[model samples]
Target: MRPKEIQEKLNIDGDRIKLFKREGIFTPENPPSGNRSTNYTDADCEHLRLLVVLTKSGLTCSDIRKLQEGECTLEEAIKIRKNNIDAEIKRKQNALILLSELLADKVEFETFETDHYWNVIAAREAEGEEFINTEDMYGYRAVSLIRSIKCPYCGEEHEVDLEDYMYDESSYEKENGMGPDVVYSFNSEDGYECHECGRIIQIEGWIREYPEGAYDSEDINVVEGEKD
Candidate 1:
């Protein structure tokens, strides 16, 4: 077939035909002498038409040539594109989870003292106020702050240590008040006492109030009845 005939059939210019030859999509042994040459074939024209369609569908010129040469398959190309999309989605999901965990940690850290008031109680217990056992009370208080605590029942005392006394927060609320904030009647007669002796127990809980000059460091040495 003539070059002019092939160009008319493919609806392309002479330059594009030369480009197809340079890309090695289809080659003629004898180069076309001039603008008009009968060196092109019907098969060559049909190949150029297919190349144009593939290139228009987002395939690069090199990729189109490779596909025509049987070096790669269309299914492999599609799989590569999909894999890139999947990787991008996974990256975004990981970023979201990281942000959520960071926000949760920050919020928990800020309310650290409020959540663990049991630590304060433990500190007092270490200072020799022996009515309440500190080790047992710490676990109960911590769990209570986070969830709930069981009442210090008499039946379970012989079987387990105080730390083992677990109860749901709802049950504790039903028996005792919600927390130390709410004032409730204490059974002074049946309240927690020293296990070693029959002495009245003095278990220190959270303190919500302080004296007017309680935090003043300079007044530390000032006694109530002493002159400066």
Candidate 2:
């Protein structure tokens, strides 16, 4: 109620509390006159608590004042803050995966790469561990690296044009590597029929070593046509 008592209860600087009051955040129930000092009510304490939370969410004093004036609702501020936090989480996750692969001592090139590497990194970070014991799996991944392959179904060799989704590690490792490799299942437009047997074929692919000096360019075209 008294400034000293309010400061102790709110664990805030007396001046800070005074500023909020002066800025019309919440007025004392009974105004202090002459020797009588200002005292806050239970409601005032609750308002101060909300004020502290809003400030911690990166709102300025002016923003809080607007909130008090009903310029915006608390729900709106909360939604905005949540969206910002989600964006930051995605950014950090991307950085963790990219930097880990790029800075690895011996990065491997592969057609069927797995996010097992990134997932392990995420798991280790969750436990406050930063060391990556095995960097064997970390590297850039491309979608359906096979330009053409011999089909398993009809034994026919087919030319393949893959979509971008084929290269994602999570796509292959979805459900812990139980999901089917999408590259093998292609439409007629994306995959050619086997000429020898006249059967529509899903070709098997391989993981090959990435060539040296391939990382220098923006677009690294490692594999082309069928690997003989």
Candidate 3:
């Protein structure tokens, strides 16, 4: 193949081929003759195809040279690429976790109308890390947690009415003419059959949502969503 033919067939630019030649990364099988420019063989074209793959998969031209010269094996380069991708995923996940916490903080400190509530996750961030700890994350948001329990089997979900479940402890104490501080603790040992999958879903734990301070016990403890 001629230079133009290689460009047309491989979709590689002519200047790129020339650059590869100058860098000694690739060269024409046939050197220039009296009147001819450059020529490529079938074998040369196959090598160029491999170069295309190497360049596209996050490998720089310098990296390719190192690869060709046996400075690093292809498998080693791929491992490096995989590590970079994993790091990027961690960074993005950390950012998401931080953002969710910040939004929830705003909700906690500021006053909101009865109908002005927004959504927020109930998950906590990792220790000394900015990312949310995905292992302890729950399926439902904090607001929804007051009434909803998710199934572990088929991802079916059930929710009760807040009017049927929740009551302000401080207000209840005041109605009974007793002086008491506020507390927002919810606990239940429940096992309900899911209508969708006909499987028993067990949720036996407690979660408190008091913005004042820390709790002596865990905030949320999910025993197991699906029961046998």
Query: Which numbered prediction scores highest in TM-score against the true structure?
Result: 3
Give all TM-scores, in the order shown.
0.31, 0.33, 0.37
C-alpha RMSD (angstroms) for model 2: 27.5
How does model 2 fare in lDDT?
0.51
Q: What is the lDDT of residue 195 in candidate 3?
A: 67
* Local accuracy of candidate 1 as per-residue lDDT tens digits, 115-173: 34456445644873323323323422121111122223221111111211112112122
Instruction: For residues 41-151, write the lDDT of model 2, one tens digit per residue.
Output: 888788788877777776656667777788888787667767756665655675576667766735566632457666866786697654433222344333333365555
Off by over 4 Å in 1: 33-38, 78-228
User: In angstroms, how far off is 35's CA in candidate 3?
Assistant: 4.2
Computed on alpha carbons, the lDDT of every model, listed in order, comes to 0.42, 0.51, 0.55
Per-residue alpha-carbon lDDT of candidate 3 for residues 115-199, written as tens digits (9 for 90 to 100): 4322222232324433434432532122223356566777766662221222232312344533332344433334345667766
Q: Order of all candidates by lDDT, from best down to worst?
A: 3, 2, 1
Ranking according to TM-score, highest score first: 3, 2, 1
Model 3, residue 104: distance off in Å is 19
